[model samples]
Target: MKILVCISKTPDTTAKIAFADNNTKFAADGVQWIINPYDEWYALVRAIELKEADPSTVIHLVTVGGADCDPIIRKALALGGDEAIRVNADSHDSFYIALQIADIAKKGSYDLVFTGKETIDYNGSSVGGMVAELLEMPYVSLATKFTLIGSEAEIVREIEGGEETDKVALPLVVSCQKGMAEQRIPNMKGIMGARSKPLNVVEPVAADTLTSIASFDLPPAKASVKLVSPDTPEELVRLLHEEAKVI
Candidate 1:
């Protein structure tokens, strides 16, 4: 079995976020980047688990970004991917990135594709569906559990009020979520082996970006909490009716 896992670099959670170029671009100075958590913890880890269950299974990691994304890719390799591919392009548009990944998936003839439910920075949950559409494959999103049985895959995904189960054939795409797999930390051996792993860089195919950032605005500051005395129930009621306005 061959699997393609899509990963991306994102700002560390603790990194300060700011905008530049008249609020049209992200400020990257002094910011630290890491593998997007959902990709690393759920999507990639689940692929690694599948590879572990079957040694013949080949796992390949792919990312669409410039050379600066290498470190994040290397870290993902350290977690257990057989090889990595980097698409040399820089764009925030989800369709553009999905196009590059779909191109690679076509050339590789992978049996399965995996991606995180969404990126932490943008929180855009569109890439996986776009890739599936571009490849004309079955897509299952927000998958919390995935099991492979022969050429078929059994998946459990979260829905509005409950979970839904699906069984799809090979050459399908899944967007993984929290319960998919446990996070794995790179050990010394894995880290050492990752240094020798092949990281192939490829140029992106021709695709027009359909989206652009207009501007970014920070959320308004939170209001201070108001304390209500337990003895003054009438005052609390008045406050809730007049200021809080919930009642």
Candidate 2:
């Protein structure tokens, strides 16, 4: 089986985020980048687990970004991705990014496509579904568990109140979440092997981007915590009803 995993580079969670170019561009200086955790810990790791279960399976990783994103792709390779593909493009627009990935998936004839439920940076959670739609294939989002038997797949995902189980044939796209798999750390052997893995850079297909970022501003600073005495239950109720508006 050929499984394609979509990976993305995102600013490390602890990195200080900033904006530039009149708040229209992200500030990259001094920011550490890493594979989006959803991609690494769930989507990619689950694909690796599948490969480990079946030696004939091949896992290919793909990303949409410029040359600077190579390290992130390499990291995916180090985590057991057989090969990598880089779609040379700016992935700010979800539709455009989905187009690139969908085109690759079509040409590659991948049996299964996997991606994180959402990227940490933008948290759009749109690309995987768009890719599935563009390819006219089935897609499941926020899948917590996945199992493959022959050409059929068994998937479990979270829904409104609880988990929903599903079954789909091959040529499926899934956006994975936390319960899908455990995180894998790259060992010395895997790291060394990744250095020599094939990393193909491809041009993106033509696609019209429908949206653009206008500006970015930090959230308002958090207010100090207010304490209410246990005896003054009415005060707490009043605050929740009036100030917080959460009652």
Candidate 3:
């Protein structure tokens, strides 16, 4: 089986987000970048696990970014991706990004496409479904557990009120969140192997873009906390209703 795992570069969760140049761009100064947590922990790791269980299987990392993302892609490759394809493009909206990924998948014809439920930077859970739609394949979102039974895939997903499980055939897409697999760190051997492994970069195919970023801004800092006597339930309620309007 050939699994294509879509990895994204995300700002560290604790990085201070800010805008620059008249609110037209995200401030990168002093910010740290990391692999999107869900992508690393769930989608990518699970794909690695699948390959581990089946030596004949191959896991490939795919990213839609430029040279700036090469280091991160190399890190993912070191984490166990057999090879990688860097689709050279600046992704903005979900549709535009999905089109690029789908274009690559068309040529690769991967048995399975795995990606995180959402990118931590934008938190848009739209890419997987869009890619599936572009490829005319079945897609499962927020899958917590996955197992392959013969040629069929059994996926357990979390829904609003409960869990839903389903089975699907190959040539499918799955967007993973929590509970899929534990995160793995790349070892020195893997790192050395990654340097020798191929990191192919391909120009993006022409695709329609549905949207663009207008501006960037940060939410205001939270207000100071209010302290109330522990036993003063009535005062707390009154304060919440009158001052904070939290009730």
**Model 1, residue pairs in steric clash:** none
Winner on lDDT between 1 and 3 is 1
Q: Residue 110 of model 1: what lDDT?
A: 97
The per-model lDDT (C-alpha) reads 0.95, 0.95, 0.92
lDDT of candidate 1 over 91-123, digit per residue (tens): 999999999999999999999999999999999
Candidate 3 versus truth, CA RMSD in Å, comes to 1.4
- TM-scores, each model vs. reference: 0.95, 0.94, 0.95
Better of 1 and 2 by lDDT: 1
For model 1, what is the C-alpha lDDT against the true structure?
Answer: 0.95
By summed lDDT, the worst window of 10 consecutive residues in model 3 runs over 216-225
Alpha-carbon error at 207 in model 1, in Å? 0.4
Q: How high is the lDDT of residue 34 in model 2? A: 97
lDDT tens string, model 2, 44-94?
999999999999999999999999999999989998999999999986999
Comparing 2 and 3 on TM-score, the stronger one:
3
Q: How close is candidate 2 to the true structure, as a TM-score?
A: 0.94
